[model samples]
Target: MDDLYDFQESFSYKLVKSETTSVIPSSVRKFQINFNFSFELDVSEWILSEDDESQLVSQSHHPVVDCLVSMSSAQFSSFEESQKYMEEKLTTTSSGLSRLKSSNRRELVDYALREAGKYTAGGGAHRVLNLHFDVLLEHEYIYLRDISNYDESTRHMVPAEDSSIDHALKTVEYSLDIPEMNCSVCLESLSGDDYYREELLSMPCAHIFHGDCIKKWLRTSHYCPLCRFEIPID
Candidate 1:
């Protein structure tokens, strides 16, 4: 195991609760697994530009952590086939977690497959995982140290200007559909009648929030309420 940060692993799986049939014209069920890889890095010396006159110096930069770092999926008609495919995937080029030891890696794959097997075979597919990881990166000549509690807040966030917030709201005005999720800002539903829909706004990071709530939030913090994704600011 890599000794950069303490590795903690846990997973959750559920049947994709939809009556909608598979897109493929087959009887086999498909499973989609998404991996969430988290890393702690020491970027204090990681400067984007050396010159103060450079336009890059004025732009905001934040490490992407909440998005889908990688995705892997396969269809299996039978449990045995799925287990076999996962076992063989460990040694294949398409395996996502190839950096770990064989013994530990196999254990994870087996555990995931076993959980997946519990569901009915002909059900409407399954979704598994939101796995977390810690990685260490070292260059031959450059050595980077690890920092504790590394995040955008560690460097401080600059409050976004009115122009940027206005632009974000305008984009949402043209959107045809608002997501079913709750707004992280007001902790309320973003979907409902047309009145509620008009009150919804989405940031560039795609996190939706109530228009008034997010407008107030961006005045003090430029980070997304849910993911800490940074937005352009003064």
Candidate 2:
């Protein structure tokens, strides 16, 4: 009875023969029961797939990270080219400036020699030096006053009576040999025109003049033609 109650309460069962083996012993065998359990795990599904929507979302949030950066490279290249160009220009300008300085000094020396030679040959070095002293001072060359101090005897070398007469004779001979001087008004070389022969004014200072030029000059002030020696206007 107890075994019947136990079999009714549970489905699992085991069959065994009694120890006294009242029934056939070999006919009964033991049977064991077990409960089987299983669980389904879904691991194949992806959390974030590689699709167009996912790529678009990533690009929209951080666009600069994916963009190409080349502006700095282009700017650097331009700067290098500009630096080379400036260096080339500087080299050319420096050489040109050096040549210009050399040529200017040469021209100044030549000009000084020509003017000085004229005064020395004309026997008017003192007067010529006085006139051009200011020019020398402006150019920052040696001053004429300094030179005069070195040659104290030069102050007494003015033309004397006999020397003046000799100079006049030599000048007359030279004038006869030379072609008639140019007319200052017309700037044309004169060949003793009738207008110049009668009325032309020859300044006591060294310059020859046309009658008209002298009349115009006398209207302003009484002075010698070349040097500004005061004279009677009349």
Candidate 3:
């Protein structure tokens, strides 16, 4: 399994009700909920088997610690105002949280942006956390693919053609006119003094090799051994 994405965010305040009052008191219950939190979110990508239809992926994280803050309600004009203020903080990055380093921090930032772009994305109840929390928030977001898919990008996944490959080999063979030069594969000089002169071949990348060495390599792969340039197997 590969950790492909990390998603984490924190909300600053909670809405609590008093049992003594039939109706919860309005006004932001602002007892100075001034606390900053640092956290990590990691999601892994896995394909259980080649035969499997749906991928089994897991995202995991530790629960946020209870480092509560107390604020005076007088500081808030209204409950709605406090809620709005906390929501605004969601858009801004805190200096403390951004200073830390993580391998997946970039993926975390990308995930957050994609979620914000969605009209349906929000924090609510969902599954797959593997543990229960007092408040559970589920966010549905898409991972924007950054790389081209292998199926669409290259038709060379199949076998190479005999005529095309033979042409490439002949071009390279004709260019290397030196009577004595080293074969890159076997590290031996190809000379008029040695046999197997007819067994030499050249890739489209112009690297010279013994026909045997390259043919064996090309049997499994369709790329130039030296430069990793894709061979047009067509």
Candidate 4:
């Protein structure tokens, strides 16, 4: 199971605001950085049998970790000092970074610190930066078969056509029309600032997902997540 799973990680940063507060003395640079993480898992299994049509297939997705971590910058002059500071700050946090490999964690922290440093070069006494990280691990189990005797039934999922995807893109909508709900992909709440800030895509079956999440999903399959409603492929 461990060898069959693939792990992926990504990091993004946004400078929320940089202001010189009169309350805080200009001599002090109070740099604050917040970290938000969304962790997910995708599991797939296939059991082949003598009867191709009788093969058992199962797939599921759910959030594994979702949490926020924040750290306030201390006075650091050199690059090495900054790196050490970030590593210490993140190590004490309760974020998903603790679960990642030491090397992976270092890479993520290094990248984030570098990005944050870019804007803090000439910032006011108070500068706030928000960083979002996504960690995904996909696990799959399938019987090993001889390529000479390959079968089409082995391929379960089909990719949608480009035209069909375009139509779906045009159907992007918001969740404000409906009551509070969760996006099936990321498992995050809808009808809030997150969904409102970004458009949500609605399938023909009336199921809605985060625009970015559904866009990534549509790249691999045309079926609606919940109802499996097929968007016609031209």
Candidate 5:
């Protein structure tokens, strides 16, 4: 029993509505449905979980906390101002906290989004890198960290510009025998009647792909999808 708590723990609280006596009528009382957040940190391995997702926001030079503290809407002043600035904002925005309901994880997330919108509207939005998701699946919980800002994309796009465009064009025009080789991207042969007339592209490394397919691929990738000859981002 003692060892089990080292890894996991659970709690239960009975939200009382009103005191009932043996002579008085009693109504079933339950806890209000409201979303709140909790977190843990290593004080080490700080960069492990954050290294990849940080780029999702397109920030280059600053640490995660640095970006959040800079947000004018977020009332955070320093790392130490945890409760006063954040709690005050959340409580003030909660106009109908007693009515909110979250019976499951998805409903909980929806409640959170509504609360966040209320908080942001009330001018108490704060930027921080510490908040993340706690997803429950199959009676287990998984932790996932995320940025507080809702506007940023969580996916990466292809780098802009291409250094070997001229060489690539020549490779497609002079070397391709469309009927004999498949476009490496869609994995469909140019010989098919469906693509007999569609434009094709080639990389300097000699890989071929449908013109439209390669165009979209290049937006998110700078290398030949097959050979990985790096296309320059200029």
Candidate 6:
């Protein structure tokens, strides 16, 4: 009986050792990680999961142990790298958008004019002109008379200058003199009754004005009549 008991104890000890020896160390166990990525306009997220089942079970015995052991150093490093890359990309994209907005003022004006034009077509000539005028005025507080001079025939003529900046400044001045039509630029009424007649000119950005005004403007600068957006003259 003593010998039998000794043999049983020896067998149990050997079995335990064998089991322990078969298990790979936590560091040696090959683990595969899968990353799930989510893409959005404002933010992004990632989920990490293990790919191997046998390795995962071998790493921990209890359910709680499984959770603790599942996380690997390599996986952590990968996640951190991915997060940094995403942050940098987002910052670059935001900066690009801001620059685009600042540099594309003329483009914005042109787009607005094109959209407004669609509604002006087939409308009364006066109505069409008024619509265009209103659209321009909405964006810029300019006087109506600077761009539209009245002739002896009471016909409206465009200014002869191509400089949109000058036109804007003149409009502001005119607005100031007229009290009844209190111009915001001048904060006064337009006092002049004199009117001139001339043909209007159109810029590549789709802004329209008197030919002379645009020409003179172009001599000094090349930009939209309403916005100081850069134009490629060459």
Model 3: lowest-lDDT 10 consecutive positions: 126-135
Identify the superior model by lDDT, candidate 3 or candidate 5.
Answer: 3
- Every model's TM-score: 0.32, 0.22, 0.28, 0.40, 0.30, 0.18
Q: Find the candidate with the highest lDDT and give its number.
A: 4
Off by over 4 Å in 2: 1-175, 178-180, 184-186, 192-198
**What are the per-residue Cα lDDT tens digits for candidate 3 across 3-97?**
22433433222222111122323653322223233332232322223233323333333233222222233423354454444344432232122
> What shift in Å separates residue 223 of candidate 4 from its native position after superposition?
2.1
> Which portions of model 1 miss their true places by more than 4 Å?
1-157, 173-179, 194-198
lDDT of 2 by residue, 59-165 (tens): 00101101011112122234444334323332232111111233433343334333334434544313212112111101111112222133323321122243332
Off by over 4 Å in 5: 1-157, 160-167, 171-177, 194-196
Q: Least accurate stretch of 10 residues (summed lDDT) in model 4?
A: 1-10
1-234, model 1: which lDDT tens digit per residue? 002212233322222322222343353234444333332121212212223221111122222222123223544445566656655553332112333356655565555555444443445444443343333221111112233333454333357878877876544553445433555544344565665454667787777777888888788667675555766775
Global CA lDDT computed for model 1: 0.45
- Clashing pairs for model 3 are 30-71, 31-70, 31-71, 31-72, 32-71, 32-72, 124-138
**Runs in model 3 lying further than 4 Å from the true structure:** 1-159, 171-181, 192-198
* Models, CA RMSD each: 14.3, 60.0, 22.4, 11.8, 22.3, 37.7
CA displacement after TM-score superposition, residue 22 of candidate 2 (Å): 99
Report the error of model 5 at residue 20, Å: 69
Native-referenced Cα lDDT, model 2: 0.27
* Tens-digit lDDT string for candidate 5 (1-234): 001111222322221122212231133132111223321111110111233342122211111110011122232323234334433333222121111122332343343444434434543323221223332211111223443433323222235365445445442552445555655444345544653556666666767777776766676656565544666666
* TM-score, cand. 1: 0.32
Ranking by lDDT: 4, 1, 3, 5, 6, 2
